[model samples]
Target: MPPLRTAFDALARLRDARAFHPKGARVDGELTTLDAGPWPLPAGSAQVAARLSKGAGVPDGFRDVLGLAVRVPLETGPWDLTFSTIGSLTRILPFPARGWCDASYSSLAPYRVGGQLRWLLARAARDQPKVDASLRAARRLVRGGGFELVLSSATAIGVPQPIARLRLHTVCDDAGQPTFDPMLNHPPGVTLYPDWLTKARELAYAGSRAGRA
Candidate 1:
């Protein structure tokens, strides 16, 4: 039998879509460091590119796992952070949401930051429209300041530290967006944990790229 990546690649080619988060919309944003303590992201502010998508390619009006992938320019390279709507900081499990405004998103995996493990999470505000899967309603967050970025420890203990405010500025054209791969396009400050899982995702992403071409 073929390996998992080969099978996934075949399916992606057959469908002509991503292996996961196939339906996504790109957005440009700015990251403002809230008067918070130090974190992995750059100091002060930085320009960001984001993609909001639905897992399983579910249609609108239906609850589906949501994904948030953001890229920030760094001195080392581009830093890509991928997140999924999750239940809680402790669980690190996927949670389906009705809309972009009401979802709680987390890394769904562990990361090492400055030699310590951490998880990135976000909670959306209600001002945005509900049941709009396209995330167009959430654009208000960029100007109004509603999206909150937080960081939690690997143990899932203690309160999550506030990182920064991530605001979606405008929708970006698909032709201009960069291919985000958290596995490879990461800055020095963030490192995916567990050697085995990292290798697995690396292979999966490589296969996904092949199928797309």
Candidate 2:
């Protein structure tokens, strides 16, 4: 079977198994806001300008004015994943000169559960034809549109479902090449992980039935 097909099969089975939830604590992050109405260095020394003047760059300016931040923990697992309920984009003009894109992702935490979803997904790809077909479709979507494959994870709570939502904000140059816009590019998607508590409840029920037998 093709490599993409194998990967797709693993993801589907992992999703079906509902491996999102595990036992853990609720996850959260520091709060941040967007102050400047838009970008391109607005007019007067507005609140955003004041902050920017004292700072070196855009991300830094946002951190001061809007209280935005970068994901510090980098490679280690995330503290929590944010969910996106709504998303939108728009263009603004007539002043300091600029354009903007926006997106929001809510947040949640997944308890530390065994990587059952990961294991199942890996097993499914062994010889699944349907998985291959899905992979082909996904590849077409990525090429036709502009998308990059990041990573695919599984959860039990919203297993077989999507919980977190992500939004990307970019700044376009004269040539139309988009540069990174820290203010808007955050918590890329809405993510739903399984709830360990719920999983435990279900397990308890299953155990009770076995005892009766």
Candidate 1 per-residue C-alpha lDDT over 44-153 given as tens digits, one digit per residue, 9 for 90 to 100? 88888888888888776778888888897778888888888876434467888777767678887777765567777776543544446555444444445444444333
Largest TM-score belongs to which candidate?
1
The prediction achieving the highest lDDT against the true structure is: 1
Tell me each candidate's TM-score.
0.85, 0.18
TM-score of 1: 0.85
Q: Can you write out model 2's per-residue Cα lDDT over 76-154, one digit (the tens) per residue? A: 2222222211122211111111111122111222323342322001011112122111222223322333211111233
Q: Cα miss at 112, model 2 (Å)? A: 15
**Which sections of candidate 2 miss by over 4 Å?**
1-76, 79-133, 147-213
Task: Report the error of model 2 at residue 53, Å.
Answer: 46
C-alpha lDDT of residue 150 in model 2: 15
Angstrom error of the Cα, residue 169, model 1: value is 1.5
